[model samples]
Target chain A: MSSGLAQPRIRIPRSARAGEAIEIRTLMEHPMESGIRGANHAAVPRNMLSRMVVRMNGETIFAADLRNGTAANPYHVFFVRLQRSAEFEFVWTDEAGRSVRATARVAVS
Target chain B: MTTASRRALLLALVALPAAARADAALEAAMREAVGPAEPEEGGMALRLPALAENGAQVPLTVTVDSPMTAEQHVVSIHLFATRNPTPGVASFHLSPALARAEVQTRIRLAEDQQVVALAVLSDGRVLRATAETRVAVGGCLG
Candidate 1:
């Protein structure tokens, strides 16, 4: 909870047509250790970013439950249809109860 | 027990011997994702590179054929790497706000294996799809 999971990045188009689905991508840096092997050969004890939530304006649009098999540095791409300009909020929470938040705004025409 | 020690116990428990996976494990994972719902093999497409040389970070996509309106939309999408030490990969929950039933991410596979995707629709239908990838090197361990 003290340190790790460096800068997270999110990508979204600056503008989109009303009623059209727009793409959204997010990446968070973490080891996502599976804890499946023994001794030094194994991953260093099951440190994973366990959850992700994406919200439009204030309503949640997408969420994901991550696990050991989700690979190091979680990445996800999803879509949302816009009827008007809105702000998006993304939150990533790890198993140790640490969390990070980011936001982006999209202009809809 | 302290959370740290409990997690350490979990880590100790997962020190496993990766073995050949069985179909039942995949089915169990599917069942765990959605209680008592049998997934039908249609309405979803799982995209994975046919030959993924790097199993650590294989680009993957799962798209379900749904209008994604409030009347009828995907409730969630579950992914499984059947051959990994842990078969359950991830689960994505969707709402009409998403407007489309599609998602993309990266997954880790233990070996040449079949990956499955299950789409749980708002109308109580579970649609499924599977793809096979040949993994040259596993990323589970050094």
Candidate 2:
């Protein structure tokens, strides 16, 4: 198994002004391999770091389908409109049918 | 044989079986986690550090491009490491109302190996992505 590690360290403000959009920044460690070739001349198996969904106050904010063109350990930043304090959830999936998840909360002032 | 030779022989005999057992256990875990699945191109992204000096605390992230709409969303995500002691890193289940399709965390890379990600949508469509990482020695050697 290639370093069987997870990705992305996200930071979210604990609180935000009401009705104001809050910033959500995420940094994940990834190799983001093109899978053209593997180590030691062995054919690298096909895998993916595809699909991410973000929710704010239980509402979907952003989602995407990624590809080989993406760089390793992808970094993403986005904003969500906040009306009140709510739990933010983030999840990601890979090609080998694996998944990693994390959560953060923000208070709307 | 001298005492030193006898000790060396005994050590080898003991070490051989322990190593073999560990290898077998690891293999079984990999087979159970990784099933027969073709690589589906597109719809996923992996973010990793440009360079990792340590393999034990390598940070990783997986993101899938999907709308968490009532009609559509990501159901689950799977991660695999081909050369690690344990290939299956983690699996995630999403709540329909949660609607968050991205996950992030730190992982232990046994060595420098390619990592793969797969996402299953509520509609049953699967998306995939991959990334190769370099882990320095003395970092993941343990």
Candidate 3:
């Protein structure tokens, strides 16, 4: 498990047309250790982010429940159809019960 | 039993728990992600190396045949490994503009396992693929 300080960096375009589709990308710094391997064939407990939430204008757009096969430093990309300018919030909670949140603003044109 | 034979037996016994745990986690993750999608044999193509010298940063790519338009598009792609701690790899959401219905990335595999990739279509149909990989020691073995 990573230290409590790590968090995902969320990015959303500053401005988007009211009816245009926008791309959202999220990147997190995590070891994603499987906890099944060690330097000398020992058992390590699995550590990874279990869930992620993406909200647009306070409406949930995307939610994911992650598991062991996830790659280290996991990166996720998703798209949402923008209806109006709003604040997009992305948050993730790992299996260790740590939470990190980020926000991006999109202006409708 | 002789010392060498005893050691071998001990190792095999130890492996049982890890294997069982991996199997359970993989099953649970699959159930949660895509419930009973008629587990296909190899409908999707997984492009990964035969042997990963470094387990920490193995490149993984998955592609499926789909026409990405307003009519029908791939809604998502999920990656999974049987032996990895989380069993569930990363996932991506696609749109028509993505053009190619493919995803590429670097992943960590603790050891060999049946890697499964799943694709959910716009019409709520699920397609899956699997690949077996042999992993070695090198990455995140702290």
Candidate 4:
């Protein structure tokens, strides 16, 4: 359950038309160890990002509950309708309580 | 018990829990996500490669047909891997703020099996879909 190196990455268009749906993708660095790996479970224990939240200007637009089945370096792609310029925050948290956050801004003209 | 018989029994036991537990876990996940409402098939699209070269990361996309309005929209989506050590893949929660009821992510596949998805609508309806994927190499065992 070591998340010491957790890093969050996000991709979003810097600009978009008002009311247009924009794509947002996020990736976090983690082993996402399922704990079932290796011989007799002697290897890495279960460790994975359990929750992910995407908030736009303080209001959540999307969220995900991840499980051990989620692949390592968890990645997600989704769409959100932007009405104006907003600060988008993405946070990923693991079962160990370690969290990584990243922010991006989208301008709607 | 004879040695050969014991070995066969051990093998059988080893092979049973992964699938059996998966059934129970997946069933509970579905029940919890859908509540008392019975899931109605269709309206959800699950996209996965027919074959995946690497089981560690298989791309999956799920889309549900809905207006995504405040009055009516998809509430959440649940994914399950039929043959993994653990079946629950992930769940995506949606709101009207999202323009579409679609989510894309990557997951692990222990072996060649079917992937299931359930979409719970805001109005208490559950949509279900499944897709099969063949993995060249099994994951979850490092």
Best by TM-score: 4
lDDT of candidate 2 at residue B17, scale 0 to 100? 68
Per-residue lDDT of A20 in model 4: 96
**Which ranges in model 3 have alpha carbons more than 4 Å from their true place?**
A1-3, A17-21, A38-47, B1-32, B39-53, B59-77, B83-86, B90-106, B111-114, B121-124, B131-142
**Number of the top-ranking candidate, with DockQ as the measure:** 4
Per-residue lDDT of candidate 3, residues B49-71 (tens digit): 88888777777778778766768
In candidate 2 the C-alpha lDDT for residue B64 amounts to 80
Candidate 1 residue pairs that clash? none
- In order, what are the TM-scores of chain A for the candidates? 0.88, 0.82, 0.86, 0.87
Model 2 docking grade:
incorrect
lDDT, model 4, position A21: 95
Q: Per-residue lDDT for A1-109 in model 2, tens only?
A: 2336575598889987876655677766666553443232224654657766677666665654444334356566554556678898777767665677778988777
Please rank every candidate by lDDT, starting with the best.
4, 1, 3, 2
Q: Report the Cα lDDT for residue B33, model 2.
A: 38
Of the pair 2 and 3, which is ahead by lDDT?
3
A14: Cα error in model 2, Å: 4.0
Candidate 2 local Cα displacement, residue A50, angstroms = 24
User: What root-mean-square deviation over C-alphas does model 1 reach?
Assistant: 7.9
- Estimate, for each residue in B1-142, the C-alpha lDDT of model 4 and write its tens digit: 3488456656755888654555666667777767767678899899999999999999999999999999999999999887776678998889999989999999999899999999989898888899999999987765
User: What is residue A32's positional error in candidate 1, in angstroms?
Assistant: 0.8
Considering summed lDDT, which 10 consecutive residues are worst modelled in model 3 chain B?
B91-100
Model 3 lDDT on a 0 to 1 scale: 0.70
How well is each residue in B36-56 modelled by candidate 1, as lDDT tens digits? 876788888899999988989
Q: What proportion of true contacts does candidate 3 retain?
A: 0.32
Chain B TM for prediction 2: 0.69
